[model samples]
Target: MNKGVVKMDFSEEKILETALKVVKSNIAGAKVCKPVLASFAGRKGQKALTIEIRLDSVKLKYRVEIKAAVTKSDKMLLAMTNKETGLPVMLMTQYVNPEMAEELKQIGLEFIDSAGNMFINQPPVFVFIKGNKLKEPVRCAIKRAFKKAGLKLIFALLTTPGLENTTYREIAVAAGVSLGSIDYIMAELKEMGYLRRRVDNSLYLEQKDDLVRRWVMAYPEQLRPKLTLGTFRGPEKWWLHGRLPSQDTMWSGEVAAHKMTDYLHPETVTIYCRPQKLNGLLLSNRLSRDPVGNIEILEKFWNNDEKSASGELVHPLLVYADLIASGDPRNAEAAEKIYEQHILQLVR
Candidate 1:
């Protein structure tokens, strides 16, 4: 393969075209056919393209999903989509690195990429290719609704019922963001098909699970870093007796998971509090700032009243995000419990 940039539009048609070129060139007696748009009932925003692959005389059809980027969270959803449709679902993306490629193959899901990296396990067409690199990565415009302040606003809408239908000022207050950002964020949500206008002209939020997944993936990168107050070292079992003024502080990460699910023993503690209260919290808990500390405090981004009924703990969504972001297997397991018991209804 030539290491040259291929400037192309990032559309379903273009993605399929680029990937199939590699498929035909690499596999013997492979034939490409036009793809058809595939839509499923009860799944509004999940769309795929049905592509046909001919190996000699045998033809295999796949529900080809097109994605700009794929992550671990996508694995379960892709598997469920395959089961629901009873057709082999193949993922077509810009690239699938070695780690994700192995995980996807382990789950028996097929995938292909424009870089010529692929895995196909259907009988009579066992093709596995890896280590091919793209000359340059494709870039796309990111929507505002997934960025920092926009994420806060979207979080408010996702967790609060009828918040999207409320005034922009109220949405801003709840999200602790500027009122001016609301209109553009709402517009971007509508453009992305996550929000729709009803016949009465009120906004309706749809495809919430997908939205939640995107929010979780972007938070650690886009918003969480900007909110960090500091990391500190505290006495062992400090959280066991520590007091948080419920009005100004809340728990997250491992501590929040243990408090909410009573599952894993917390190895670290996470707190979210107003900026002005950081010193008060540390002084009260006898914590000292440390670069590599067991305790982390982030500036609280959402409003005080937005706290869920759990009181001292942030919403289950934030806890789940914290665990997933931690990249620990135990935390990931605990996050599953939080998702099932507390956060499932919010998205569905």
Candidate 2:
């Protein structure tokens, strides 16, 4: 072990207790310190360690950093901490072999070579359960199994190219749920409108009914028109006809849509948002001049587009923003009606 490096089995409680002792020993007269353990991580292939600590007292609250050498076996301790403290723990490294680097890059893991090139890791898509209604053990077990098996399954199904329709059996197997219990949970989700059975007898988990699906599935189609327009000069010509949004935007939208769908539970209702408009000059000159105003303008633009539509528009971007701005989108029916009317126009 390197100097200043501590070798220990990873246990959240043990690490936390050791951290508190270190704090107390280091900070003389720190009687009033309240140490809240945040998270921890063990770097792969290296003994590097990092721990987040929040210290609170009457004077002020401050963060404490503890760094050390760590190994793979330490990850279990960190994961245990994450389970108990509800903080995220990430296992990462900057020194990966070229082949491993390529593989990690493909899976979207944050990585860097010895040469200092950096890559950000992609987070796993999470299926959230709402209302504190789910059994914690079951959810945790499912999440764990999903994290462990999800990438393998993704590769097995070759689902990288399109939306993969997964079954309860798949989810059950991936999530470590019992076959018998799958039906009960599926039934609950069905009743809550978070999932539906397809004609193929497979289960489709919806973020919220048909709205998220339409937006996600239709986004590329909607962009086809703007993408076909190619490069243009002004706002007037800025639309994605056939081209896709930048990778960042598409990924962000996917994540946002998934989150909204999980939370909103919209059945028979759909949420919609127009594709973000990107014109080089407009974005660089006018929008960049004032970011706050730029966002405001974008909001106004989205609102105006929705308002001008002859039918309903249910994009959560439009509805959620308006809900925050004016408290109207809170009414499920009203929001759904708006979405339906606009969607109807698009289809017609």
Candidate 3:
């Protein structure tokens, strides 16, 4: 084999250990100077990789600063973030093709990808980890398994896992898609190793967390936009902490997220109204039709009959999905709580 697949088969700590061992095996006396996280006070972000190595190699009583990148673009971004920190670099990615690997070599930077592709060039230490070059290209679009409607099916499946034993037509209606779409979705999910078929009509979620992560990443890009009818402003009084307009509406997005977690104070309100009841909402709430408005109106995606324990709330799963999609740090934190309290409870 020209290159080996770097199994993303390890936990975070194990991945770190594997990376460190790979480095140690390559260098004569490579020892870590210290572990440090690279953060700039001026920059307003927490994603800065907490670089463990104060330096890369301490060999023969000498020291060299070593910085690290855990993702593909991470290397590029860290090249800037680590500038003031004064450290040399290492880049880790999911996979690095041989052509790209060679470019890293020419640039004189040390790197390792999850695929086991690595390169290091410090004085008295020259190493290269050339993994299986990608034989085929990767598609830019999401797999058919994660298209707009498929997300809804996945959401419904997780929220109400019993759907695993139900009919495909039932899943189709619940997901707001057609029967053919469900077939393609189920097949693709099986091939991806996230689902398994039972002797009966049942289909099961195999890798629940991984599947949810994939769905969360796609929902904002593929599903949410399609569900959104428009963004508009509503009367502020309607969004008080425990009160919402009561006409066939369900609370969602940041408003719902805040209520669940108490971790964030929300400035936006997102709600779903049944298509048949949209006119009544517009008239009753006097909601304006603004493209940039905070109040978003979505036609319900799942079973309209599905009600929250409280009639005015959307399912916590939807609330979690919306918070994660916001890509805001505070909202993202709140999303985790919704996932833990609501989604996990449902699965259990």
Candidate 4:
């Protein structure tokens, strides 16, 4: 079919007239509904037009929305009419943000430039995990495998035209993961009945019936806060904070440990610090360099300093003490002695 070029004189009525002409000219036995002007801007420095066209016939009923932005040149307006309807196009350097490109994709618009060098139909997958109180180690393993394999999986699915049948090796190479890992993950998923492999080795991920239920049950209720210790402007400064699901619940040391594990495990680091006690006083004393004297110092402020009878403090000095206690069995004994002589003396 010869593509029709419809031009309007930059008015609402003219725009609708042009769209109707295009529909009548190109589609056989199709009727054009009244065009809705989605957006129209013609003022100083910006000029654009966007319209939605609806077509209905015995065989097909579909809607096409078109947006054309113009500057000094009319190239973008012309390009909008000529470009293929639903294929992704690589945008030029002039495009402002990645989101404009994504918006085009969401609307099923393909936007290639003159050179045909770009495509942007990157499919996204939603992962659903099941079970409650799963181990941290297990979650880490699953996330790592997914990151390594996700891009390849999406690419393979996009390039492969039909769903007739394919092999595991084909999917593995396309997903860029070791065959062994792919096989292992697939086996685990299948045993859980979250996936199925056909006789032809085609693998499919099944959407679970109770996916949201599993998510609600598996979500963690508490998380640990983090402590940042650094030298700001040549003076030692320490700050501690953590985000909780809500403010009503006080932070817990065990929850903090789990949060630390979640954040640091990918980097292969460990948290060696303990929760701080008598944090505010310790900050003052560490600055003063005065002997805390004995357990009395801590005992005096224990009720005032504690978040509650049950809440734990994640202090910098406590972390340092924990590290010292960890390195040498004798240092643990020394820490107790130091606490009794200095920190406890102040509180008492």
Task: Pick the TM-score winner.
Answer: 1
- Stretches of candidate 3 exceeding 4 Å from the true structure: 1-138, 198-202, 241-248, 304-307
**Per-prediction TM-score to the true structure, in the order listed:** 0.80, 0.22, 0.61, 0.18
Candidate 2 residue 139 Cα shift, in angstroms, is 24
Task: Answer with 2 or 3, whichever has the higher lDDT.
Answer: 3
Candidate 2 global TM-score: 0.22
TM-score comparison, 2 vs 4, better candidate: 2
lDDT of 4: 0.29
The residue-by-residue lDDT of candidate 3 on 1-348, one tens digit each, is 011111122343344555566555554555644433343331222112334432344242111222222322233333332333334555544456777677667655556654456776655656687864433222234467667778878877777756766788888877677788888888777776667766775667665654665576567767778877788877775676433445457888888876667777888888887777777677767778888888888878877245567677787867876766665545655765676677665543
Tens-digit lDDT track for model 4 on 1-348? 111112222332332344345345544454645433222221111112233223332322122222222121122222232242232222221121345444444443333221111122333311111122211111112222123343224223322323213566656664445666665655544554445566777765332211111111111111011122221121222113322222222332222222333221111111212224334433533422233321111111111122223333322223213323223222333333333343332222
Tens-place lDDT digits, model 1, residues 277-334:
9888988889999999989999889872555576888888888888877756566668
Candidates 1 and 2 compared: the better one by TM-score is: 1
lDDT of 2 by residue, 223-242 (tens): 21232212223232122122
Q: Model 3: what TM-score?
A: 0.61
Model 4 segments beyond 4 Å from truth? Answer: 1-145, 154-164, 197-203, 208-348
Q: Assess each prediction's global lDDT (C-alpha) against the native.
A: 0.78, 0.30, 0.60, 0.29
CA shift of 85, model 3, Å: 26
lDDT of 2 at 331: 39
Clashing pairs in 1: none
Give model 1's TM-score versus the native structure. 0.80
TM-score-based ranking, best first?
1, 3, 2, 4
Error of 4 at 42 (Å): 40
